[model samples]
Target: MSFLKRPNDFLFRTLVIVASVSLATLSLLVIYSVVMRYVFSDAPDFVEPIALLLVIVIAMFGAALKVREGGHIGLDSLVNKLPPRGQLVATAFQHGCLIVFAIALFFGCLQMVEATMEDRIPIIGLPESLRYCVPVIASVCIAMFSLENLLALFAQKQK
Candidate 1:
């Protein structure tokens, strides 16, 4: 219980909260948009565009959320077949690959955000900045998860 007070715990919680809230809010708005479109005469002009953008954010951040939560599915059948010591090595290798992937997400997102400045969404004519939010949010979450994973690796070594 006391371990929950540690800095790593704080960071993990923050990432989960951010990703979940954003996705939930977006989901709600999408439902509302559907209702309004069907029950009312015309769809809100911006509804589709806004919803589309938000949906991207939801999906991207939600991926990181899954990873951080350990809800991301693992191909453990093969690893489980290995001997105990082999399993440890495999797990460490997996985490290392994940860290690299996270780093790629963070940097790749930054590049996207910059390169999309001149791009625009077809319907909304909104600058691609709105679309880039997906990657930005994902990058942040992945970075956070990677940091947490690093700490966990070290903790395991210590134990």
Candidate 2:
């Protein structure tokens, strides 16, 4: 468990850092874009596409981080009322659902990435698949965290 904890902690911390940096970059980009548009009347053409990518990074990474922290919405009040075994089952079910959803998201995003590989983002000229790649990475993280939680739940049950 300690060994698993170390890697999981590292992953969680990395996600948090990535999300924080993305958010800061997105904020600064928005401010710069606004100032350029309003004051200089010469907004950069690349700003919109770059900002869109940054937003995807912030949102997907943030959601993955929330899963690791157990900060996402859950029916805790309802689960708490159940017996210990029932609570365990409910928790396992929740984690299972997250794992399943993350897997589906990953596959779906992969298909999107493949389908859009030849298309370029309008202003940035980068492959349009770049946008979907963010979700693919985030979904892997989400699946890992959910699996970790699910295993921990079963381990606790055994104890």
Per-prediction CA RMSD (Å): 3.4, 1.4
Q: Which stretches of candidate 1 lie over 4 Å from their true place?
A: 1-8, 120-126
Task: Report backbone clashes per prediction.
Answer: 0, 0
Runs of candidate 2 with Cα error greater than 4 angstroms are none
Q: How does each model score on TM-score?
A: 0.76, 0.93
Clashing pairs in 1: none
lDDT of 1 by residue, 1-159 (tens): 234326546655766676677678778877887888898855767767777776676677677777677666566899899997787677667766776776777677678878888898876898886676667666666656655665675677678
Q: Estimate the lDDT of model 2.
A: 0.90
To one decimal, what is the Cα RMSD in angstroms of model 2 from the true structure?
A: 1.4
Q: Which digits, one per residue and each the tens of the lDDT, describe model 2 over residues 1-159? A: 566667888889988888898889989999999999999999888888899899899899988988888777789999999999899899889989999999999999999999999999997799999999999999999988888888888888788
Poorest 10 consecutive residues by lDDT, candidate 2 = 1-10
